[model samples]
Target: MTGSAGGRRARRLAIGTAVMLVLAGTNGPWLYRFGTERYHEYKINRPGYKAVNGHWDVVEFPKEYRQDTIHAVLLHTGKVLLVAGSGNNQDNFDAKRFDSRIWDPVKGTVKKVPTPADLFCTGHTQLADGDILIAGGTKRYERLKGDVKKAGGVMILYNENPDKPMTLPEGTRFTGKGNGKVFLSDDSVLIPRATKVFDRKTGRFLRNNPGYARVVVEAPKEGTRYETGTQDGYRIGGLTGADARNTYGIANKLGMDKRDFEGIRDAYEFDPVAERYIKVDPMNEARWYPTLTTLSDGRVLGVSGLDDIGQLVPGRNEVFDPATKTWTYTRHKRQFPTYPALFLLQNGKLFYSGSNAGYGPDDVGRDPGIWDVATNRFTRLAGLRDPDRMETSGTVLLPPAQDERFLVVGGGGVGESRLSTNRTRLIDLKAAEPRFVDGPRLAKGTRYPQISVLPDDSVLVSGGSEDYRGRGDSDIHQARIYDPASNSFRRVADPLVGRDYHAGSILLPDGRVMFFGSNPLFADKADSRPGVFEQRIEIYTPPYLYRDSRPSLSDGPRTIARGGTGTFTARRASAVRKVRLVRPSATTHVTDVDQRSVALDFTTSRDRITVTVPANRNLVPSGWYMVFAVDGRGTPSTARWVKVP
Candidate 1:
């Protein structure tokens, strides 16, 4: 009887095992994917793996505190200032719903600050007094050709009266002499007084060169019939006598074509401590995508942007005086594409990397060169590969400002083109003839790569799209550390989020890097759905931070003047082998002209470390900086804020 029972049980077990194998075969792919994902998570989270490749964590603010951040600046207070004016949202712009946020990364707190204007696509830089100088913004969003209903174009308003300027208010009508088409000014314009030109050789007057202003004018009603193709003189309405004769307008075309974004002249100074924006004198020119670079003398230089008339500024640059809180035009004229990567050289000249965000003629101002702002002379640099693919590229002043080396990262073709390059270029300004040479290549062609100078003297290059605006789901998730000492790139852990257009990274005070903003053109590989702006901020803790422990830095002087010394207490002072004075970053569109890691001469004692700041004003600009003490193992302590007054 026992033998019969054992045979029956064995038969039942065989039947069950066969049924289970059949079910597993039916769901093989799903089971494999689930197991693979679980294994990845477990591997990345492992302590051993983290110690080698670091890790990434996402910071998602509450729904009410979320914003479409377009620009981020690391303030002196260790809080990040996030600005998202209208946030590339046309609906928000129409409703005047601008946004700015102050986030404390350590405390995980967020606060909203009232934004005064549409600071979208504006330029910002760190000031001498720890304030952030913000200038330019969007005045009008772009309207595509098919979406444009009004017949509108640029109108050159002429003021022939040398005695006085003319101001034309919005809604001012202009009737063309030939076509008799009535077009109205979309915004108010101020035309300067006519310049009375005189012959240089003789005392006799040559003629009155009429002072003109370009304004966008549109037909009163929307239709293709109101479009005009030819140039015509226009009669000004509500003007009589001399006003009528002196204030006429001339326009070459007024057709229902695409209209690009217009810019505003609004400017402000953001006070980090007070957590408010102080209104300052507006810029001389309305700018949509400008760059604010710090001059050697401490004044702020504003350059390269789309003007109020939706055209390039025509090389008319300006300067901002912090003491006077005013802007004055520079004597020289030099044009560039919007947000050109201009860095200040130790010799007090400016270097243009030919890296720009967008907007300008392909042939004009596309060459990388050294610019003499004083004389308006540009000396072009040779050996730049893929020069035609410079738009959206990133330029970084390599670690140790004393070296005067720069690296230009990957970029894409001009305007919405699918072309991209994986080449990296390096230049040494200290050389007799500084020219670009090929460096390490990226795994894929990239654009909008975020480059940050780490405290350990290595640069972190991460995040970019292989196509324009990450179209076709081409956002690269890779990160690399470029060692200037080795002149090579080492691949690190991949980022969790995909960053492309409008994205940037900033080195935080805690020795980690923070990334913000990603404006992709499409969401899927097939480009079927419109892409959404990435609002979650991602923090990357480098491998150096995953070690056993970091050196502790404390009790440092709040201010250190140029060519001065400051002593700070560090328990692991003997292990501290390097000291770096890193300037805070103000980044947008992968352009960060403010950040540079300056090496400091240091001596370590039993329990204290003394560091000396460089005497060169151009090398170490007057501002607040993060003083980091790196141990022998390349572990950096939490930064101690120091002011270079």
Candidate 2:
């Protein structure tokens, strides 16, 4: 053999070895998972997954909130509104000491805002005018009688004046009603104050305190009137003790107390531009644990919550017309479980995904289905193996808005059981007969996992707990990015602080993610061991940001007409591959129904580009959207707000 021929053969062998090494290192055994479309479909829990690149940093907060922020919504003006009604602690509510702030992410400052009502546990949605309609919260706590029996404490379900017998959960309790003769259902009718009652059979309540049942009653009273055109005024009261207990907890008890909190029918419009909260016309009925979704017609739909009387607000769906700045009751009545994670289908229907933030009867509300707003009709979707475990879970409408697909991820077990789920599911609403299909699982089961739609079209799932709320050390700090194309999740960098219930994340206009808030049992107790309330702010920079030079918009109109085309200059136009308009997110309870990304059709030459707006209001609702120019490597530029009128 010739010496030159031998050298060429060795070179070919070296090249082949390098290629094999790259393939093995990148995907290993799961390389075939991405090899075909069928393979990708079944790659829900694929092994040897590729981890997405990202890093997190804890930012210094300008001032201490002193309260746990259980709710956060991003505003169009690039500031975040933080609300923690009563801070999940009634002591704050009793004193009328609430924490509401506007956090400027760019300036690292928080401006305190006074809340008109207890915004805690309320539903919210962004209006087309970029204002937030804050609905339903505690007016005040309610008092009820509880009888301690050998089996369990039986709570008199008289708060709402129920016609039938209703059972309350075991852990549900009320407190601070004043010391008196406690009543027991045993052979003994009366027990002295501060005496513990023992339930020998269940071995559960073995304390010296025998729970008592009493008929301490209070009538509904007229509340402070806000300027609403609905009626002369609204009344507040008749709420169950259980509803109060679930939200604000029993009034005025210290250390892990859960007995205070009531549902207030008061609603408000938070104007970010003016930085003021305007008391709006309240809802016709009260709602706690409700969900607010922006409809395609530019109206906001309010659904499923405990009424003023603390019963699940039944079949009375209302729509808030931003045009009129008022809530109009729908002629149709609908029943949805509390906080049913609802999404607006492109065809102008609501899809209830069986994801809730924990409330109501377990069995009835766990069904996932689609509902027509006009006729009030429902079509059930099957195939969720752990449908009952969706409490405190998170769901998102997959990006490119036109896809009409949804994803549900990470929920807890039934009824405050501390058990969470790692399962995730996906469904295509555009399917002929849509049903849930299994998707990739999380590293662990998470409760309150925040799902944010990233600019690159991948979904970011981060910050939750394996147990109920933020109990124990179960807070999950790790984050995952779901890639729809691959049908898999790439684990990303973990945050410094672990977040669970009440924690939230939103995609900043600058392409970074801002993580904030976590309200555990005693998360606000800084003196307590392990402290409380994951209050520090953290920002995550995705790997794409470090990949290549990002495209930037130098000059663009602040507003555009529907279906119109305009020219904008983007520096580094040669690197630009995609231009997108993303609606700023209004998030709470791990759900952001208003969030979406619409790709803009564009033609580019040199440093100038002409982009066409969405053809109609249905495609991209008339509102302010963050416009970005994404480079070929998928890194997005700092967004500029563009209003579609």
Candidate 3:
């Protein structure tokens, strides 16, 4: 004890003194509760593996994701990493059963990234340093049947530098966060609600030094609880800052939370020295599940989210000025559905990749404004290919000459009778009109398959459950690669775990791609075991490794089989970019590829490029079979229609 005021006097004390301490005291400014509590269990266990086939566009196809799935995906370097988890499993903490695995397209093998027991939901991200940073995520019990509230947000650092054999760094349990974005900063991370301070060097959630907040408020010398008329009851006046009440600001206008106004939150900076989270300025729209993209100019562009839905009122998009706490409305208006795909172009143009709002039959005549950043005005991008029909997902492709176009992919649309599309398209800005180019028909099945284009123009179409109409098979683990140059496909390794919903696909910096599946297998004739959800991750490379054989022609080419020049239905070697054939060319008029086959009504033929036999007057005409493929690029394949009956 020290005696002050007059002269400091040191008092002699006993030898030993014990000081009790609690761990939570270290990081306790904010308290948050997160996780699935409705059922006390998460239903969809397996997360799906995301692929940025060719250029990353399009979202999960409906037919493909009808099974079950994981969440987001990333394509880094060459390897693909997918986040998948299983809530039905007895051991929730098993990374093997939950984390991701790398698929080697070269070796044709799958390997897992070794991780801590609590590493589920696949929050791991690779840093520039080559170390994989497994950021905070929920923890499932290692052996327990039910979901338990263990650690909210914990970060486990791992290293896969050489990558030959991956390495898991030591674990440091960070107590405060739940589920949020793990932004890669210089050395540390700008983690949302990160309460605990972790030491990357020491590999531990440290409790030493000024790693905590210590409150020391001045106490008035009074009669304690029995005191009266002392203004001691707790005052909450400061919660509303003086500048907010005095200045001409929107906050003053929104005295109470209003339905008309967007609910905006401010940017907060965590001061390690003060151990406190200081609020700067709130975002324009107080939105959740929102997306923020950092621009080339270093400004973060926040966009599309469900702010005003029906009577509930959701958020649109607004920009935030970090220096000041004010929000600027960027005028991003929405109509019906709010889920849109965003793409930042290299040309410094912010291209909106979704639909122009108010689009019902009754709303078709209404015109929406196209955004022009230069004048801050909305103009018309007439020649632009908009995803008006299907809500398409697309990404910016980084190729040397790919500066003028965007590779757009997937979306669901009403098909003929019971048919639908799992195909992708492209928009070439290089063209004066920037028209859309419909892609080739996807492999036999629907959804679950993706297209990732390599530097060689070959696309890696991955995991999607397709219904084999003739075989009665609802799901197929088939994978294939399509070369645009040859317009042919070759089979690759299919996924062991079928992909379902909430699946994401990303392109890695390397060539290797990863696929992760979520939930139990929901494919047709699937194994409905309790823990069948693939919390597993696998990697994939192209199939060109195993076989170096050339893409041989199906036997040889000769227009229509012998016996006849086929129907020789006037056709030629020509261009077929955006043309959709609905009727056969009139025998009086000629067209591109000669049609060898025909139906009863030669005028309204549904199928194109068929092989037709000569007048089979000698015998009853043979039954017809649809064409599997054709040599459209050059020379003829079959000369006559071969009889099936």
Question: What's each prediction's TM-score?
Answer: 0.97, 0.74, 0.39
1 or 3, greater by TM-score:
1
Q: Model 1, 1-645: lDDT tens per residue?
A: 356888989988999889878867998788889899999899989999888888999999999999999999999999999999999999999999999999999999999999999999999999999999999999999999999999989999899999999999999999999999999999988999999999888879989999999889999998999999899999999999999988899999789888999899999999999999999999999999999999989999999899988899999999999999999999999999999999998989999999999999999999999998989889999999999999999999998889999999999899989999999999999899888999999999999999999999999999999999999999999999999999999998899999998899999999999999999999999999999999999999999998988898899899999999999999889999899999999999878999999999999889999999999999988999999999989999999999999
Off by more than 4 A, model 2: 1-52, 63-66, 141-261, 522-531
Candidate 3 local Cα displacement, residue 384, angstroms: 9.7
Candidate 3, residues 517-543, lDDT tens digits: the string is 433234335434332444444555443
- lDDT of predicted model 3: 0.31
Task: Give all candidates' CA lDDT scores.
Answer: 0.94, 0.72, 0.31
Question: What's the true lDDT of residue 274 in model 1?
Answer: 98
> What TM-score does model 3 achieve against the real structure?
0.39
Off by over 4 Å in 1: 1-23, 199-202
Best candidate, TM-score: 1
lDDT of 3 at 134: 27
| lDDT for position 550 in model 3 | 17
